[model samples]
Target: MSENEEGTPERTDVRKEEEDSPRDRTRLSDICADVKISEVMSEETTVVRESESIEDIIELMTRTPYHSFPVLNENDELLGVIGQDNILELLFFERSHRHHHTHLMAIKALSEDASTLMVHHPVTISPDSTLCDAADLMIKHHIDRLYVIREKKLAGVVSRADIIKKIHGLRRQ
Candidate 1:
């Protein structure tokens, strides 16, 4: 309301500007802040042994729908994850066999193991970490997934897809 000729004070909605701000809609924190990661984590994780031959590992990776697999040592220690980023080299190496390439990767001939291909010391999240924390980690590291660790072992895995599914479920309910 505008001031009247009698010098009355005007009234305006203080929340209007904030409600229309673009930043409010884009920040993942607002949606994920209150949720716990464990609630949305995938417990049926596919973990591979670090000493497994690369061919075996590749077969396991292809057999599963998951884009990444946690690599563990003989003692079941969390070694790292064999993520999509790690598989690109294999794709190129395989590509080399069907046709000539500008560059030849020495990896094609080596009988390497998961220890050689898995990303070492991958970033891990605590089982109790909030979904927002997981989102921040994923964004900061440019990763699509995070392994939830408990007692230095793989408790589960959480992916961006899982987070999205959780959000969708929440919206539906």
Candidate 2:
């Protein structure tokens, strides 16, 4: 039994299974070591269509509070990706190229579609990939999220937040 500040008895018998084993205590790092991408990936992905207007994409970004999204083709196959940085770069390019009023620059960029703005060939991962691999990929590529693909089609999305959530859930601290 464990006691809090009030000195009330608290159950600390979570070690039941491991009680008889040599490793009675659990470490968060050990628990999170075996976690795979499929275990933490978000299946409900919000992707953008290749034909959607850049304005629509931007609105989707602001409205949904999403920083990035995968761009798909007519067949729903993964095409590319568009992130906040990508959109901002395009907008900046428009402003520089046009050298016009802000409103006119926005209107000009709005006419552009996903195909023109998407960052082609985004980094992807497999469902079987370990969390360590995913993290390594993100660090190596300087990305915040990864698209989980199967059979050349998008299956889910895994992000830094997801990894953090999984580790937090271990509760071994």
Candidate 3:
């Protein structure tokens, strides 16, 4: 017998079966294939304002193991980056000076201000960028993290740790 005008019985059954089935299980190759930065990025990222004091920044770093932070302006625009190394250098400089006490006091004073020593114009990336692109940028710049931007706004962060995690996960399979 001829099928109905709407849809043939066999076709309808096939459509229903396809809809009932779950999405195809991805292979390890598919998971690792051209992985995008957004796929592995950490959505929960710590940020610091440009006006924040160095002392406060140091305190925040102590609370977490974050090696770097993206500095933002009052409008939430990325201004630069400040890494733990920079803070350590400042501390070392204060300690080595002949006028140790004066230098210590000066360091303390400088820590209260943000713009005095913060790195300006940090490297940034778009959320849609591939993981390979982010990794390349990190290697080229010798940076540990890349700020993910979406529509000119901070979206998330892609760090070396995140990339390592992806590699670890892939290795398990």
Candidate 4:
């Protein structure tokens, strides 16, 4: 007898055939169903004002996991972003041994205005835009996140991780 009969009836090497039918491609609506920018966004976003002190900004960075934040003006208008890199640059310049302490102090005094250090005119995306659009914008600009706007106000923020999670979820299906 063959191995199949000798053993407990070795399973047949039969493969189920897929029906000869065309599968419906997923549409944007389907991909976005029940998913909103507000749903996926990190709602508890850290924000700093243009007038915030560098010390305060540094403290915020130390306390939060975010590397960047949306800066707001006194009127709550979007100013730009302040990131960890910006703070690092300032600290490094201030502590450089090549510069005299007096000179470093002078520079620090003039750098008190956070607006001067904040990035101006950061790219932003609307909250209603498709995730694909957001992903494309990030890819084109080589950025990690996009500030989500709604009614010309900061509504939420979308990051690369959010997009990756959505893609991974679809793959599992």
- Candidate 2: list runs displaced more than 4 Å: 1-33, 94-111
Evaluate model 2: give its lDDT.
0.79
Off by over 4 Å in 1: 1-31, 90-111
lDDT of 3 by residue, 36-62 (tens): 878889988788887788779989999
The digit string of per-residue lDDT tens for model 2 on 65-120 reads 78899999887789999889868866776456545546744554555888767878
TM-score of each: 0.69, 0.71, 0.66, 0.68
> Local error of candidate 2 at 31, Å?
3.9
Question: CA shift at 141, candidate 4, in angstroms?
Answer: 2.6
lDDT of 4 by residue, 32-64 (tens): 554566656766678988899888898889999
Instruction: Please list the residue runs of candidate 4 whose C-alpha ends up more than 4 Å from where it truly belongs after superposition.
Output: 1-38, 94-109
Best by TM-score: 2
Residue-level lDDT tens digits of model 1 in 138-157: 88879788888888878888
Instruction: Kindly provide the TM-score of model 4 when superposed on the true structure, using C-alpha atoms.
Output: 0.68
List clash counts for every candidate, in order: 0, 0, 0, 0
**Top-down TM-score ranking:** 2, 1, 4, 3
By lDDT: ranked, best first: 2, 1, 3, 4
lDDT of model 2, residue 41? 98
Clashing pairs in 4: none
What are the Cα lDDT values of the candidates?
Answer: 0.75, 0.79, 0.73, 0.72
